[model samples]
Structures are given as C-alpha cells and as structure tokens.
Target: MKCYLVPCVAGFIAFNENLDIVDYELFPRRSIISKLLEFEKGLTAEEEKIIKRLLKDYGKISIESVHRWKYGKFKGVILESPNIGGEYLRENLREILKEIGFIKDGEFQEIIYEIHMGMTIKRLEESFREQDKLIIQAVSTLDDLDESIGKFVERIREWYSIYFPELESVKDHEHYVKLITEHPRREDIIKLKKLPRESMGAELEEEDIEIIREFARAIRSLQLLRKSIEGYIESKMGYLAPNLRDVAGTTLGAKLIAHAGSMKKLALLPSSTIQVMGAEKALFRHLRRGSKPPKHGLIYQHPLVRGSNWRVRGKIARVLASKISLAVRKDVFTGEYDPNIKEDLYKRVSIIREKPKKKGKKRR
Candidate 1:
C-alpha cells in the first residue's frame, strides 16, 4: 500500500511512531529496487527496506493497492477532499506531478500494477528457459545420433564386406541398412535375388548374419530416435516461437532462439545482431585479430541462403536476418502470426537467389 501511496497526495502523510515526518527523500539510490521506486519522490530508507523484503516474495506484494493506484484511484481523493491539507498538497504538487509526466501517461501506474501482479511472468519466463535448455539438449542428442548412425552403418558395410563385398558395392547407404535389418544372413539376402544376377559376395553362415543383425538393430533404433526428436523440436518450436518457426522453419528457428538464450533477449537484439546468429567464434576472431568480419553466420543454414550461390549468400543472409528480426519482434510482443511476412520474405529471397551476373572486360 505504501508503494503506491508514495506517489499520491497522501504520500506526504508518512510519519514515524513519534509523529515525525519521514521524508520520502530518504530512499537510497544506486540500487535496482530503489530505481524502481523512483516513481515515488524521496522514499525513506525504512520504506525501501520494506519494499525490498516484500519483493523478495512476489506473493507478498499488495494486489488491491496496486489495482487502485494503477487506475489513479487517489486522483479524485486529492481533487475532491475538502480538507485544507489535501487541497494544499493537490494545488502545490499538481505542477510537479504533471512535470514528472505521470499525468500525461499511465505508464507509471502500469508499472506499479505489474510489480504487484506480475508473478506469473516470472514463472512463464522460467518455463521458457527450461524449454530452451531441453530443446538444445535434444538437438545435441540428435546430432550425436546422426554421427553414431553414420559410423555404425560404415561398420556394417565393413563387417559384411568379406562375406558380401558385392552387396556393399551395389547397395547405397539406405538400401544396405534396410537389407541388413530385413535380411541379416547372406542366405536370406541372396534368397530373393541380389541386385546383380552374378553372386559376387561370398556366402556367409547364419551366425555371421546374426552378429551383423545386432548392430543394424541398434542403428535402426537410433534413427527412429532422431526422427522423434526432430518432430518434437518442430512441435515445440511452433508453440514457443510460432512466427520464427514460420519464417525460419522449426529446427533452425529453435536453434536461433536457443542460441539467443531467451525470446525476450532475442527480441531486444538489433537486426545486425540477428544477422550473425551463430558465428561467435569467427566474430570474436575478427574482432581480436582485426581480420575481415565474415558477412554471414549460421544464418547461412537458412534454405534461401544455403541454396543460393556463394556470390549472393551474403545478400540473402542480410535480407533473411532483417526479416527474422521483424518476425522475432512480432512473436515476442504480439504473438501474432502473419503469413504475408513469411511469403514476402521468401519472395524476396527468391530474387536474391538469382546468380550474380559476370562483369565483362572493358576495352580501352
């Protein structure tokens, strides 16, 4: 209650038990909470302590008092009170209050309201941070899964090479994986008919095939997990950053948000910062060594940038970064999804994707 009254005409009524006026001027400066308290004039040190203690547990803040103050509930009290002190305070302080611009805007009252009732925002932000960590962790797992799947498949080829070198030469990575999973034994693989009519691969015993099958089974499981994480990322990113997802696609969009640490932090960034989404190492190197800064970063992974020729990668990245900046702001502030933004951005990207023209040599 004192927090709101600190700015009202009644704020002047503060007194200690001895009835001595406690000047609002006593509030300390150079501290975070004191700065928030700056809306009030000259709050005393004791009052600042109470506010700090109350704020330590957001639930303790007075909601009713904040609601009343947020609507300028005391404005009528100061104006309508017939009391001489109220009239004097109102007349003498009106100019100062107007000068402070509190009368011109309800922004200060809104801040007070938020302080009293903004606990949910803290919880939601915590939830957002947890989700980002989980997404990053899942993405890392998927990356590892990819590497493991590759290595396991390569081993599968080597293991079967002596028995069915012909199969290794004929089948591509995917088909070989499928054949191993479905027909681990040489007898089974050659039963239907190999790709080539001539059996170039030596026949293997059923036991040799069983050993290979165990490894194939594990790799197949890893692939399924990778697919699951990809889908999970897509669904979660859509929920967390819908506009970013629409503009950047789920995986890259989540990567961008995760890289930024939080949506609010990302939204606060300038378009230039968004431009260099993931080139921290290169950027730091350039800054330290006075080397030429790279034009693009991980944003090059965006389809528009990646598909474009190197000559135009920088241009496409710039445009994409600018659009992503706008999209991120939209998602963070309004949570509104506008398809036109995505469509227009891709249209512009298409034009940028065109190969740069070669310059002809000039004759003197």
Candidate 2:
C-alpha cells in the first residue's frame, strides 16, 4: 500500500495563501433586520405574508445562534417553511418572554445574551465529566490496537501515587521509570537477574519496584491506543475543523459544522483549509458577493489542483466532490436527502450526458 505524505511546505504555502484569501479579500454584509424594516414600510401584501411567517416561526431560531446568523458570524442560515400552529405558539411564547422581562420593548439582544450565558455555564460545569468519558470511550474503541498500553499508563500513574508523595502524581518521568522496573513482568525480571553481570535491579531501591511497575503500565496503555488515538483525534478534530489539535489541544473539540463537508474529506483536508472554513464571515462574504467561493469547505479535498502529477488523486477528488455536492444540494446532512439514494441516482449523470448513436455507426 502507498500513502501520500503531505509536504510540510505544500501545507504551509496552501495555508498562508488561504489565510490571505479569507483575511483580506472577502465581501461585506447587509443586515437582514434593516432589509426587513425597509420592507415593513413598503412591503406588498405578499411580502407581509412572508414577514408574518418569519415572525410565526421565530422560536425555531435559537436565540444565540440566530444572533450569530444576524451578525453574519455563522456561515449558513437555513430556514424551514413555517407550519400551521403559528399564532397560538407565538402568543404563549410572548407571554413567557414577558414574564421573563424579555418581551416588553422587545429586548432581543438581552434575551439572546441571557440564553447564551446560560448555555455556557451549563457546558462549563459538564466539561470535565464529558472529557473523562471521551477518554475512556477513545481507549475502548481501539480494538485492533494492544490493550496493554492503556493498562500500562494507568498502572504507572497508580504506582507513582503509591510511592512518590511529593511529586504527588504519576505524570512525571522519574515516577514512570520507577513504576516500570517494580512490575517488570516477574518472569522477565527473574531471567534478567540470573545473568552474570546481573540486571539493573541492584541499582534500584525498594520504592522503585512499585514505581517501575506503574511506569510500565502507563507505557503499555499508550502503546495500545497509539494508532487508534491518532485516528480518534483526527475524527475528533473533524467535528470542529482540522489544525485545531495543534492550537487548542484535546479539550475544546473540533469547531467546524456539518455543512463544511463529510468526515472523509475533512479528514483529508489540510489544517489551513479547515481554519478558512471556520472563518464564516469571509466564506459567506465570497458566497454572497457572487464571486468564486473561497471553497465550499471540504470541496477542496478533491484533488483538482491546477498543477499536480497525481491525476488519480484528482479523479478521486472529483468523484468525492460530485457526491458531496449532491449531498449538499439535497440537504442530506439535515436528514432530508433521499433514503434510497443509490437507486435514485443510478447512472443518472451518465444517462443524461451519454452521446446519441450516429447514423451508420457500427457497434464497437
């Protein structure tokens, strides 16, 4: 099997150029509220109907997410058609807003801010537990990898706590070494001790045995999860964007949204591209300005560079892009794309583009 290693220079150059495209050459935004106000004064009855519909379904818009959408802080804003139960729900919702002092004079900003703050507080309180669970789940998912690696890391930490009080934790290097020797699989240690020059045991102190055991356990755990953890981190980062691991560590999670592209393309994208996608303001700017899009996110993952020897990679990219474009057009990410999608699209493109048979043309 062959693997393509992304050249450091290529990734860096692509990233810097991408940053320039986003940071300096994006378009301006026009406010929807301002547009609405203009329409309020001059709108026709049909326009009025649409405005009422928007008002009716306003609750579906998350207050904070909407605020971001309004300010053009988010990349996409998809609105579903309003349903029948509008007025009754709005009236009851208005009453609740009034009780909370958010309806009178209609302090939309204040209400949004309050909801955002509430969510933030809730998330902060839950983060530690969430992270611990993620760690365990990540460890368990690596079935093909060695399980001893995880056990080793755990035992190392445990032994450090047992022996070294001042260090207070097994995370240190000294503690790791101490733990490894202490629990050096007894059979292996005995064989080593029987040698003429003898093993390192003569130099090891009594406290070191437990510490060495703990160290070995820690190393073993790490070994078990090494490859899977790399894949896990890649998958994890895809949830946000690429390149975040280097910047944000393992805590904050990936920042990109689902529309950026599918997980496969995202995993293949360079970090710079991911960051560019996350810069919603710039991306939306290009899109709204009717210019060539900065890149519809993972669409760039298609191997269509202007100059590249890897024609095969480009073909693969085109196929992937075509599928992704179809997914996006159908709003499949939102679960609205066809369920029997395979049957629906069978040779659809080929059928449409196939050339007609010519007169007197012989069958090849």
- lDDT per residue for candidate 1 within 197-288, as digits (tens), equals 55566777777777677667666655665677788778777776788888888877777777887777888988788888788888898999
Error of 2 at 181 (Å): 10
lDDT (Cα, tens digit) per residue for candidate 2, span 1-364: 1111111100100011111111011111222233323333443233333323333433222111122223232222233223122222333443433443434744533443344333323332344533323433343333323454445455555554443332333355534444344545433433544422333223446556643654454454445335546566466543433222322223222322233334334445554455345446767777789754443343333223222234233333344334433433343234253434333333443443353534686799
lDDT for each candidate structure: 0.61, 0.36
Worst 10 residues of 2 by lDDT: 5-14
- The alpha-carbon RMSD values of the candidates against the true structure, listed in the order shown, are 24.0, 24.1
- Compare the candidates by lDDT and give the number of the best one: 1
Best by TM-score: 1
- Candidate 2: segments with Cα more than 4 A from true spot: 1-203, 216-309, 328-364
